[model samples]
Target: MRGTPTLLGRPVPLGEVAWLTVVWLLLWGDLTVGNVLGGLLASSVVVWLLPLPTLDSGVRIHPVAALVFLVRFAADLVLSSFRVAFWALRLGTSPPVETVRVRLRTSSEVMTVLVTVALSALPGSLVLEAELEDRELVLHVLGIRGDVRATVQADVTRLEGAIVAAFGTPADREEIR
Candidate 1:
Protein backbone atom coordinates (compact mmCIF):
# COMPACT_ATOMS: atom_id res chain seq x y z
CA MET A 1 0.00 0.00 0.00
CA ARG A 2 2.85 2.35 0.75
CA GLY A 3 4.40 1.86 -2.63
CA THR A 4 1.14 1.51 -4.51
CA PRO A 5 -1.94 3.65 -5.12
CA THR A 6 -5.65 3.34 -5.81
CA LEU A 7 -7.28 3.51 -9.22
CA LEU A 8 -10.34 5.78 -9.43
CA GLY A 9 -11.93 5.23 -6.01
CA ARG A 10 -11.08 1.51 -5.82
CA PRO A 11 -7.72 -0.23 -5.69
CA VAL A 12 -6.66 -2.21 -8.76
CA PRO A 13 -5.14 -5.38 -7.36
CA LEU A 14 -2.12 -6.28 -9.47
CA GLY A 15 -0.51 -8.16 -6.59
CA GLU A 16 -3.45 -10.58 -6.41
CA VAL A 17 -3.26 -11.11 -10.15
CA ALA A 18 0.45 -11.88 -9.94
CA TRP A 19 -0.07 -14.32 -7.08
CA LEU A 20 -2.86 -16.15 -8.86
CA THR A 21 -0.82 -16.49 -12.01
CA VAL A 22 2.11 -17.92 -10.04
CA VAL A 23 -0.05 -20.40 -8.13
CA TRP A 24 -1.80 -21.58 -11.26
CA LEU A 25 1.48 -22.01 -13.08
CA LEU A 26 2.96 -23.97 -10.20
CA LEU A 27 -0.06 -26.22 -9.61
CA TRP A 28 -1.05 -26.93 -13.17
CA GLY A 29 2.38 -27.04 -14.79
CA ASP A 30 0.67 -26.44 -18.11
CA LEU A 31 0.77 -23.35 -20.26
CA THR A 32 -2.23 -24.23 -22.44
CA VAL A 33 -4.61 -21.56 -23.61
CA GLY A 34 -7.44 -22.86 -21.45
CA ASN A 35 -5.25 -22.96 -18.38
CA VAL A 36 -4.01 -19.46 -19.12
CA LEU A 37 -7.56 -18.22 -19.49
CA GLY A 38 -8.62 -19.89 -16.27
CA GLY A 39 -5.65 -18.38 -14.44
CA LEU A 40 -6.48 -14.96 -15.80
CA LEU A 41 -10.09 -15.30 -14.77
CA ALA A 42 -9.11 -16.43 -11.28
CA SER A 43 -6.68 -13.57 -11.01
CA SER A 44 -9.30 -11.05 -12.13
CA VAL A 45 -11.78 -12.39 -9.62
CA VAL A 46 -9.28 -12.18 -6.79
CA VAL A 47 -8.26 -8.70 -7.79
CA TRP A 48 -11.84 -7.54 -7.94
CA LEU A 49 -12.59 -9.00 -4.54
CA LEU A 50 -9.47 -7.81 -2.74
CA PRO A 51 -8.60 -4.22 -1.91
CA LEU A 52 -5.29 -4.20 -3.75
CA PRO A 53 -2.85 -1.37 -4.21
CA THR A 54 -2.03 0.29 -7.51
CA LEU A 55 1.33 1.15 -8.93
CA ASP A 56 1.17 4.94 -8.91
CA SER A 57 4.86 5.71 -8.63
CA GLY A 58 6.22 3.30 -11.19
CA VAL A 59 9.64 1.69 -10.77
CA ARG A 60 12.60 3.55 -12.22
CA ILE A 61 15.51 1.40 -13.37
CA HIS A 62 18.75 2.06 -15.16
CA PRO A 63 19.66 -0.94 -17.27
CA VAL A 64 23.38 -0.28 -17.59
CA ALA A 65 23.81 0.46 -13.90
CA ALA A 66 21.80 -2.63 -12.96
CA LEU A 67 24.02 -4.77 -15.20
CA VAL A 68 27.18 -3.32 -13.68
CA PHE A 69 25.86 -3.91 -10.19
CA LEU A 70 25.09 -7.55 -10.96
CA VAL A 71 28.53 -8.11 -12.47
CA ARG A 72 30.31 -6.59 -9.47
CA PHE A 73 28.13 -8.54 -7.05
CA ALA A 74 28.93 -11.82 -8.77
CA ALA A 75 32.64 -11.09 -8.80
CA ASP A 76 32.59 -10.14 -5.13
CA LEU A 77 30.68 -13.31 -4.32
CA VAL A 78 33.30 -15.45 -6.00
CA LEU A 79 36.20 -13.66 -4.34
CA SER A 80 34.59 -13.82 -0.92
CA SER A 81 33.86 -17.51 -1.44
CA PHE A 82 37.52 -18.20 -2.11
CA ARG A 83 38.56 -16.07 0.86
CA VAL A 84 36.21 -18.03 3.11
CA ALA A 85 37.53 -21.34 1.79
CA PHE A 86 41.13 -20.28 2.39
CA TRP A 87 40.32 -19.17 5.90
CA ALA A 88 38.50 -22.43 6.61
CA LEU A 89 41.51 -24.51 5.49
CA ARG A 90 43.84 -22.76 7.93
CA LEU A 91 45.57 -25.43 9.97
CA GLY A 92 45.32 -25.14 13.75
CA THR A 93 45.60 -21.36 13.82
CA SER A 94 43.09 -18.61 14.36
CA PRO A 95 43.49 -15.63 12.09
CA PRO A 96 43.43 -12.10 13.43
CA VAL A 97 39.79 -11.12 13.64
CA GLU A 98 38.36 -7.71 14.37
CA THR A 99 35.24 -5.61 14.19
CA VAL A 100 35.73 -2.51 12.10
CA ARG A 101 33.42 0.46 11.90
CA VAL A 102 32.73 2.03 8.52
CA ARG A 103 31.11 5.36 7.78
CA LEU A 104 28.77 5.30 4.81
CA ARG A 105 28.53 8.16 2.34
CA THR A 106 24.88 7.96 1.31
CA SER A 107 22.27 8.42 3.99
CA SER A 108 19.65 6.51 1.99
CA GLU A 109 17.82 3.89 3.99
CA VAL A 110 17.37 1.72 0.88
CA MET A 111 21.07 1.91 0.10
CA THR A 112 21.98 1.06 3.68
CA VAL A 113 19.60 -1.91 3.70
CA LEU A 114 20.96 -3.17 0.40
CA VAL A 115 24.54 -2.88 1.61
CA THR A 116 23.73 -4.78 4.81
CA VAL A 117 21.91 -7.50 2.90
CA ALA A 118 24.64 -7.92 0.30
CA LEU A 119 27.42 -7.94 2.92
CA SER A 120 25.60 -10.54 4.99
CA ALA A 121 25.17 -12.72 1.90
CA LEU A 122 28.90 -12.64 1.20
CA PRO A 123 30.86 -15.45 2.89
CA GLY A 124 33.74 -13.75 4.75
CA SER A 125 31.95 -10.66 6.05
CA LEU A 126 29.16 -10.18 8.57
CA VAL A 127 27.36 -6.96 9.48
CA LEU A 128 27.56 -6.68 13.26
CA GLU A 129 25.40 -3.61 13.58
CA ALA A 130 24.35 -0.48 11.74
CA GLU A 131 24.17 2.87 13.48
CA LEU A 132 21.65 4.63 11.27
CA GLU A 133 21.71 7.80 13.33
CA ASP A 134 25.48 8.10 12.87
CA ARG A 135 25.49 6.62 9.33
CA GLU A 136 28.03 3.96 10.28
CA LEU A 137 28.20 0.19 10.16
CA VAL A 138 30.19 -2.31 12.23
CA LEU A 139 31.42 -5.38 10.36
CA HIS A 140 32.96 -8.54 11.79
CA VAL A 141 35.68 -9.69 9.49
CA LEU A 142 38.15 -12.58 9.51
CA GLY A 143 41.78 -12.74 8.28
CA ILE A 144 43.00 -9.24 8.89
CA ARG A 145 46.20 -9.27 6.82
CA GLY A 146 46.83 -5.53 6.63
CA ASP A 147 45.29 -2.42 8.13
CA VAL A 148 41.89 -3.66 9.21
CA ARG A 149 40.49 -0.18 9.42
CA ALA A 150 41.47 0.80 5.90
CA THR A 151 40.40 -2.51 4.41
CA VAL A 152 36.97 -2.41 6.02
CA GLN A 153 36.48 1.19 5.05
CA ALA A 154 37.44 0.45 1.47
CA ASP A 155 35.16 -2.54 1.33
CA VAL A 156 32.22 -0.52 2.59
CA THR A 157 32.98 2.22 0.12
CA ARG A 158 33.01 -0.24 -2.73
CA LEU A 159 29.66 -1.60 -1.62
CA GLU A 160 28.28 1.89 -1.37
CA GLY A 161 29.45 2.67 -4.89
CA ALA A 162 27.82 -0.45 -6.25
CA ILE A 163 24.55 0.39 -4.48
CA VAL A 164 24.63 3.96 -5.72
CA ALA A 165 25.21 2.77 -9.24
CA ALA A 166 22.31 0.35 -8.99
CA PHE A 167 19.67 2.46 -7.27
CA GLY A 168 20.67 6.11 -7.12
CA THR A 169 19.60 8.60 -9.77
CA PRO A 170 22.05 9.21 -12.59
CA ALA A 171 24.80 11.55 -11.49
CA ASP A 172 27.94 13.18 -12.83
CA ARG A 173 31.36 11.75 -11.91
CA GLU A 174 31.32 12.22 -8.15
CA GLU A 175 33.83 10.26 -6.11
CA ILE A 176 32.08 8.34 -3.33
CA ARG A 177 35.19 8.20 -1.20
Candidate 2:
Protein backbone atom coordinates (compact mmCIF):
# COMPACT_ATOMS: atom_id res chain seq x y z
CA MET A 1 0.00 0.00 0.00
CA ARG A 2 1.17 3.48 -0.73
CA GLY A 3 2.03 5.53 2.37
CA THR A 4 2.68 9.18 3.08
CA PRO A 5 5.59 10.68 1.18
CA THR A 6 8.73 11.38 3.18
CA LEU A 7 12.05 13.18 2.74
CA LEU A 8 15.35 11.66 3.92
CA GLY A 9 13.45 8.74 5.51
CA ARG A 10 11.41 11.15 7.63
CA PRO A 11 7.74 12.08 7.15
CA VAL A 12 8.43 15.80 6.88
CA PRO A 13 7.07 17.90 4.04
CA LEU A 14 9.55 20.51 2.88
CA GLY A 15 6.87 23.16 2.39
CA GLU A 16 5.62 22.81 5.95
CA VAL A 17 9.15 22.76 7.28
CA ALA A 18 10.07 25.90 5.39
CA TRP A 19 6.89 27.74 6.43
CA LEU A 20 7.32 26.75 10.07
CA THR A 21 10.92 27.84 9.96
CA VAL A 22 9.93 31.24 8.60
CA VAL A 23 7.36 31.58 11.37
CA TRP A 24 10.00 30.61 13.93
CA LEU A 25 12.42 33.21 12.61
CA LEU A 26 9.70 35.85 12.70
CA LEU A 27 8.83 34.92 16.29
CA TRP A 28 12.46 35.31 17.31
CA GLY A 29 12.73 38.58 15.34
CA ASP A 30 16.10 37.48 14.05
CA LEU A 31 17.63 35.68 11.08
CA THR A 32 20.98 34.34 12.26
CA VAL A 33 22.65 31.08 11.28
CA GLY A 34 21.99 29.52 14.68
CA ASN A 35 18.40 30.65 14.60
CA VAL A 36 17.90 29.17 11.14
CA LEU A 37 19.33 25.82 12.20
CA GLY A 38 17.28 25.82 15.38
CA GLY A 39 14.14 26.63 13.42
CA LEU A 40 14.81 23.78 11.01
CA LEU A 41 15.32 21.31 13.83
CA ALA A 42 12.29 22.52 15.78
CA SER A 43 10.04 22.44 12.72
CA SER A 44 11.20 18.99 11.68
CA VAL A 45 10.63 17.60 15.14
CA VAL A 46 7.16 19.18 15.38
CA VAL A 47 6.08 17.78 12.02
CA TRP A 48 7.38 14.30 12.80
CA LEU A 49 5.89 14.15 16.28
CA LEU A 50 2.49 15.44 15.18
CA PRO A 51 1.69 14.05 11.75
CA LEU A 52 -1.36 15.51 10.01
CA PRO A 53 -3.30 13.92 7.18
CA THR A 54 -2.97 15.79 3.91
CA LEU A 55 -6.02 16.96 2.01
CA ASP A 56 -6.17 19.09 -1.13
CA SER A 57 -7.95 22.34 -0.21
CA GLY A 58 -8.23 23.44 -3.85
CA VAL A 59 -6.98 26.98 -3.29
CA ARG A 60 -4.62 28.90 -5.55
CA ILE A 61 -3.48 32.52 -5.49
CA HIS A 62 -3.56 34.77 -8.54
CA PRO A 63 -1.24 37.66 -7.79
CA VAL A 64 -3.04 40.20 -9.95
CA ALA A 65 -6.46 39.32 -8.58
CA ALA A 66 -5.11 39.13 -5.06
CA LEU A 67 -3.75 42.64 -5.39
CA VAL A 68 -7.08 43.85 -6.67
CA PHE A 69 -8.83 42.21 -3.72
CA LEU A 70 -6.43 43.77 -1.26
CA VAL A 71 -6.87 47.23 -2.70
CA ARG A 72 -10.65 46.99 -2.67
CA PHE A 73 -10.61 45.58 0.86
CA ALA A 74 -8.47 48.44 2.07
CA ALA A 75 -10.86 50.97 0.61
CA ASP A 76 -13.80 49.18 2.17
CA LEU A 77 -12.03 49.06 5.50
CA VAL A 78 -11.37 52.79 5.44
CA LEU A 79 -14.92 53.66 4.40
CA SER A 80 -16.43 51.36 7.02
CA SER A 81 -14.22 52.83 9.68
CA PHE A 82 -15.49 56.31 8.91
CA ARG A 83 -19.11 55.15 8.84
CA VAL A 84 -18.80 53.40 12.17
CA ALA A 85 -17.11 56.41 13.72
CA PHE A 86 -19.91 58.67 12.52
CA TRP A 87 -22.48 56.37 14.05
CA ALA A 88 -20.60 56.26 17.33
CA LEU A 89 -20.46 60.05 17.56
CA ARG A 90 -24.04 60.62 16.50
CA LEU A 91 -26.68 61.79 18.96
CA GLY A 92 -28.99 59.78 21.19
CA THR A 93 -30.41 57.46 18.53
CA SER A 94 -28.41 54.33 17.64
CA PRO A 95 -27.80 53.30 14.07
CA PRO A 96 -30.35 50.86 12.71
CA VAL A 97 -28.85 47.41 12.90
CA GLU A 98 -30.03 43.94 12.03
CA THR A 99 -28.90 40.35 11.77
CA VAL A 100 -28.68 39.65 8.07
CA ARG A 101 -28.42 36.17 6.65
CA VAL A 102 -26.44 35.94 3.44
CA ARG A 103 -26.50 32.90 1.18
CA LEU A 104 -23.18 32.28 -0.50
CA ARG A 105 -22.88 31.03 -4.06
CA THR A 106 -19.64 29.16 -3.46
CA SER A 107 -19.41 26.62 -0.66
CA SER A 108 -15.66 26.08 -0.60
CA GLU A 109 -14.35 26.08 2.95
CA VAL A 110 -11.40 28.27 2.05
CA MET A 111 -13.63 30.79 0.35
CA THR A 112 -16.03 30.74 3.28
CA VAL A 113 -13.24 31.41 5.75
CA LEU A 114 -11.81 34.21 3.64
CA VAL A 115 -15.21 35.82 3.33
CA THR A 116 -15.85 35.52 7.06
CA VAL A 117 -12.56 37.10 8.01
CA ALA A 118 -12.88 39.89 5.48
CA LEU A 119 -16.40 40.79 6.56
CA SER A 120 -15.63 40.65 10.26
CA ALA A 121 -12.64 42.91 9.83
CA LEU A 122 -14.84 45.73 8.56
CA PRO A 123 -16.00 48.10 11.31
CA GLY A 124 -19.78 48.01 10.85
CA SER A 125 -20.16 44.32 10.14
CA LEU A 126 -19.50 41.20 12.16
CA VAL A 127 -20.02 37.63 11.03
CA LEU A 128 -21.85 35.87 13.87
CA GLU A 129 -22.01 32.36 12.42
CA ALA A 130 -21.18 30.39 9.32
CA GLU A 131 -23.46 27.52 8.40
CA LEU A 132 -21.27 25.36 6.19
CA GLU A 133 -23.94 22.89 5.16
CA ASP A 134 -26.30 25.70 4.25
CA ARG A 135 -23.58 27.78 2.63
CA GLU A 136 -24.88 30.75 4.58
CA LEU A 137 -23.45 33.41 6.89
CA VAL A 138 -25.32 35.22 9.60
CA LEU A 139 -23.95 38.70 10.16
CA HIS A 140 -24.76 41.51 12.53
CA VAL A 141 -24.65 44.67 10.48
CA LEU A 142 -25.00 48.31 11.55
CA GLY A 143 -26.32 51.39 9.68
CA ILE A 144 -29.29 49.70 8.07
CA ARG A 145 -31.63 52.03 6.18
CA GLY A 146 -33.86 51.74 3.13
CA ASP A 147 -32.91 48.79 0.92
CA VAL A 148 -29.88 48.22 3.11
CA ARG A 149 -30.38 44.47 3.00
CA ALA A 150 -29.99 44.42 -0.76
CA THR A 151 -26.93 46.65 -0.48
CA VAL A 152 -25.36 44.38 2.11
CA GLN A 153 -26.08 41.31 0.02
CA ALA A 154 -24.52 42.93 -2.99
CA ASP A 155 -21.47 43.93 -0.95
CA VAL A 156 -21.03 40.35 0.24
CA THR A 157 -21.43 39.02 -3.28
CA ARG A 158 -18.84 41.45 -4.57
CA LEU A 159 -16.47 40.46 -1.77
CA GLU A 160 -16.97 36.78 -2.60
CA GLY A 161 -16.29 37.45 -6.25
CA ALA A 162 -13.10 39.25 -5.35
CA ILE A 163 -11.95 36.41 -3.09
CA VAL A 164 -12.81 33.75 -5.66
CA ALA A 165 -10.90 35.64 -8.31
CA ALA A 166 -7.88 35.91 -6.04
CA PHE A 167 -7.53 32.49 -4.38
CA GLY A 168 -10.22 30.05 -5.45
CA THR A 169 -9.98 26.73 -7.29
CA PRO A 170 -10.45 26.65 -11.06
CA ALA A 171 -14.05 25.52 -10.78
CA ASP A 172 -14.74 28.10 -8.10
CA ARG A 173 -13.30 30.90 -10.19
CA GLU A 174 -15.40 29.90 -13.15
CA GLU A 175 -18.55 29.54 -11.06
CA ILE A 176 -18.02 32.94 -9.48
CA ARG A 177 -17.59 34.66 -12.82
Candidate 3:
Protein backbone atom coordinates (compact mmCIF):
# COMPACT_ATOMS: atom_id res chain seq x y z
CA MET A 1 0.00 0.00 0.00
CA ARG A 2 1.16 3.51 -0.73
CA GLY A 3 0.48 6.55 1.43
CA THR A 4 -1.49 9.45 0.04
CA PRO A 5 0.58 12.35 -1.20
CA THR A 6 0.54 15.41 1.03
CA LEU A 7 1.33 19.04 0.31
CA LEU A 8 4.95 19.09 -0.92
CA GLY A 9 5.18 15.40 0.07
CA ARG A 10 5.37 16.39 3.74
CA PRO A 11 2.93 15.38 6.48
CA VAL A 12 3.60 18.55 8.48
CA PRO A 13 0.94 21.25 8.41
CA LEU A 14 3.17 24.27 8.88
CA GLY A 15 0.86 26.81 7.32
CA GLU A 16 -1.96 25.95 9.68
CA VAL A 17 0.30 26.22 12.73
CA ALA A 18 1.72 29.55 11.64
CA TRP A 19 -1.76 30.90 11.02
CA LEU A 20 -2.95 29.70 14.41
CA THR A 21 -0.04 31.36 16.16
CA VAL A 22 -0.75 34.63 14.42
CA VAL A 23 -4.40 34.45 15.39
CA TRP A 24 -3.52 33.70 18.99
CA LEU A 25 -1.16 36.63 19.20
CA LEU A 26 -3.70 38.97 17.69
CA LEU A 27 -6.50 37.79 19.96
CA TRP A 28 -4.73 37.45 23.31
CA GLY A 29 -1.82 39.84 23.34
CA ASP A 30 -2.13 43.06 25.36
CA LEU A 31 -1.33 46.36 23.64
CA THR A 32 1.59 47.13 25.95
CA VAL A 33 5.32 47.09 25.23
CA GLY A 34 5.93 44.19 27.62
CA ASN A 35 3.07 42.16 26.16
CA VAL A 36 4.19 42.94 22.65
CA LEU A 37 7.69 41.72 23.39
CA GLY A 38 6.37 38.59 25.08
CA GLY A 39 4.02 37.84 22.21
CA LEU A 40 6.75 38.30 19.66
CA LEU A 41 9.05 35.97 21.57
CA ALA A 42 6.35 33.34 21.92
CA SER A 43 5.37 33.50 18.28
CA SER A 44 8.97 33.40 17.12
CA VAL A 45 9.75 30.40 19.32
CA VAL A 46 6.71 28.51 18.08
CA VAL A 47 7.45 29.29 14.45
CA TRP A 48 11.08 28.30 14.83
CA LEU A 49 10.35 25.04 16.64
CA LEU A 50 7.59 23.82 14.33
CA PRO A 51 8.37 21.70 11.24
CA LEU A 52 6.21 23.41 8.62
CA PRO A 53 5.50 23.11 4.95
CA THR A 54 7.09 25.68 2.68
CA LEU A 55 5.53 27.65 -0.16
CA ASP A 56 6.90 30.51 -2.21
CA SER A 57 5.20 33.87 -2.61
CA GLY A 58 5.89 37.53 -3.18
CA VAL A 59 4.60 40.88 -1.94
CA ARG A 60 4.03 44.20 -3.72
CA ILE A 61 3.89 47.67 -2.18
CA HIS A 62 1.86 49.76 -4.62
CA PRO A 63 0.72 52.86 -2.78
CA VAL A 64 -1.32 54.40 -5.57
CA ALA A 65 -3.17 51.20 -6.43
CA ALA A 66 -3.81 50.48 -2.75
CA LEU A 67 -5.26 53.95 -2.29
CA VAL A 68 -7.51 53.49 -5.30
CA PHE A 69 -8.82 50.16 -4.04
CA LEU A 70 -9.47 51.60 -0.58
CA VAL A 71 -11.37 54.55 -1.99
CA ARG A 72 -13.52 52.38 -4.25
CA PHE A 73 -14.25 49.90 -1.46
CA ALA A 74 -15.40 52.71 0.83
CA ALA A 75 -17.58 54.21 -1.86
CA ASP A 76 -19.14 50.84 -2.66
CA LEU A 77 -19.88 50.26 1.02
CA VAL A 78 -21.65 53.59 1.32
CA LEU A 79 -23.62 53.07 -1.86
CA SER A 80 -24.66 49.56 -0.89
CA SER A 81 -25.73 50.73 2.56
CA PHE A 82 -28.09 53.29 1.03
CA ARG A 83 -29.48 50.74 -1.42
CA VAL A 84 -30.17 48.26 1.36
CA ALA A 85 -31.80 50.94 3.50
CA PHE A 86 -34.07 51.91 0.65
CA TRP A 87 -35.13 48.31 0.07
CA ALA A 88 -35.79 47.81 3.79
CA LEU A 89 -37.95 50.91 3.95
CA ARG A 90 -40.05 49.65 1.06
CA LEU A 91 -41.03 46.37 2.79
CA GLY A 92 -43.27 43.61 1.23
CA THR A 93 -42.68 44.52 -2.37
CA SER A 94 -41.38 41.84 -4.72
CA PRO A 95 -37.63 42.27 -5.19
CA PRO A 96 -36.28 41.29 -8.55
CA VAL A 97 -34.06 38.31 -7.86
CA GLU A 98 -31.48 37.02 -10.30
CA THR A 99 -28.60 34.57 -10.38
CA VAL A 100 -25.57 35.85 -12.22
CA ARG A 101 -22.32 34.12 -13.03
CA VAL A 102 -19.20 36.26 -12.94
CA ARG A 103 -16.20 35.09 -14.92
CA LEU A 104 -13.07 36.04 -13.03
CA ARG A 105 -9.88 36.92 -14.86
CA THR A 106 -7.34 36.42 -12.09
CA SER A 107 -6.30 32.90 -11.16
CA SER A 108 -4.70 33.73 -7.82
CA GLU A 109 -6.78 32.04 -5.14
CA VAL A 110 -6.26 34.87 -2.65
CA MET A 111 -7.30 37.50 -5.15
CA THR A 112 -10.35 35.50 -6.20
CA VAL A 113 -11.35 35.03 -2.55
CA LEU A 114 -10.98 38.75 -1.88
CA VAL A 115 -13.19 39.62 -4.82
CA THR A 116 -15.83 37.14 -3.68
CA VAL A 117 -15.85 38.53 -0.14
CA ALA A 118 -16.01 42.14 -1.30
CA LEU A 119 -18.86 41.47 -3.71
CA SER A 120 -20.79 39.55 -1.06
CA ALA A 121 -20.45 42.49 1.33
CA LEU A 122 -22.34 44.63 -1.15
CA PRO A 123 -26.10 44.74 -0.42
CA GLY A 124 -27.32 43.13 -3.63
CA SER A 125 -25.00 40.24 -4.34
CA LEU A 126 -23.94 37.06 -2.57
CA VAL A 127 -21.19 34.83 -3.95
CA LEU A 128 -22.29 31.20 -3.75
CA GLU A 129 -19.24 29.51 -5.18
CA ALA A 130 -16.13 29.78 -7.33
CA GLU A 131 -15.90 27.26 -10.12
CA LEU A 132 -12.14 26.93 -10.20
CA GLU A 133 -12.08 24.63 -13.20
CA ASP A 134 -13.90 27.15 -15.35
CA ARG A 135 -12.96 30.36 -13.51
CA GLU A 136 -16.59 31.32 -13.01
CA LEU A 137 -18.40 32.59 -9.92
CA VAL A 138 -22.04 31.98 -9.04
CA LEU A 139 -23.80 34.87 -7.33
CA HIS A 140 -27.35 35.49 -6.09
CA VAL A 141 -28.46 39.05 -6.49
CA LEU A 142 -31.43 40.98 -5.17
CA GLY A 143 -33.30 43.72 -7.05
CA ILE A 144 -31.46 43.22 -10.28
CA ARG A 145 -33.34 44.55 -13.29
CA GLY A 146 -32.45 45.42 -16.84
CA ASP A 147 -29.22 43.82 -18.06
CA VAL A 148 -27.94 42.29 -14.83
CA ARG A 149 -25.39 40.20 -16.70
CA ALA A 150 -23.58 43.21 -18.09
CA THR A 151 -23.55 44.90 -14.71
CA VAL A 152 -22.14 41.83 -12.97
CA GLN A 153 -19.53 41.35 -15.64
CA ALA A 154 -18.44 44.95 -15.43
CA ASP A 155 -18.24 44.80 -11.66
CA VAL A 156 -16.09 41.68 -11.79
CA THR A 157 -13.78 43.26 -14.36
CA ARG A 158 -13.33 46.36 -12.26
CA LEU A 159 -12.58 44.35 -9.16
CA GLU A 160 -10.06 42.14 -10.99
CA GLY A 161 -8.34 45.21 -12.41
CA ALA A 162 -8.09 46.87 -9.00
CA ILE A 163 -6.70 43.73 -7.40
CA VAL A 164 -4.18 43.30 -10.18
CA ALA A 165 -3.02 46.88 -9.82
CA ALA A 166 -2.75 46.60 -6.06
CA PHE A 167 -1.02 43.27 -5.60
CA GLY A 168 -0.30 41.50 -8.87
CA THR A 169 2.97 41.26 -10.77
CA PRO A 170 3.42 41.63 -14.53
CA ALA A 171 3.11 37.87 -14.85
CA ASP A 172 -0.15 37.83 -12.91
CA ARG A 173 -1.82 40.27 -15.30
CA GLU A 174 -0.89 38.01 -18.17
CA GLU A 175 -2.33 35.00 -16.35
CA ILE A 176 -5.57 36.88 -15.71
CA ARG A 177 -6.03 37.57 -19.40
Go through the candidates in order and give each one's C-alpha lDDT.
0.77, 0.90, 0.73
Q: Write the per-residue lDDT of candidate 3 for residues 63-160, one digit (tens) a residue.
A: 89889988998897787677667777887877778888889887777677777888888887899889977889999987667899998799778977
| Model 3: how far residue 41 lies from native, Å | 7.1
State model 2's lDDT.
Answer: 0.90
lDDT of 2 by residue, 21-118 (tens): 99999999998999999999999888888867878878899999999999999999999998889999998979989899998999788999999999
> Which of the two, 2 or 3, has more TM-score?
2
For model 3, what is the error of residue 167's alpha carbon versus the real structure, in angstroms, after optimal superposition? Answer: 1.9
- Per-model TM-score, in order, reads 0.77, 0.76, 0.69
Off by over 4 Å in 2: 1-53
Candidate 3 positional error at 114, Å: 1.4
User: Which regions in candidate 1 have their CA more than 4 angstroms from the true location?
Assistant: 1-19, 29-32, 54-60, 169-177
Query: Poorest 10 consecutive residues of model 1 by lDDT?
Result: 51-60
Q: What is the lDDT of residue 73 in candidate 1?
A: 89
| Clash count list over all predictions | 1, 0, 0
Candidate 2 deviation (Cα RMSD): 4.1
RMSD (Å) per prediction: 4.4, 4.1, 8.1
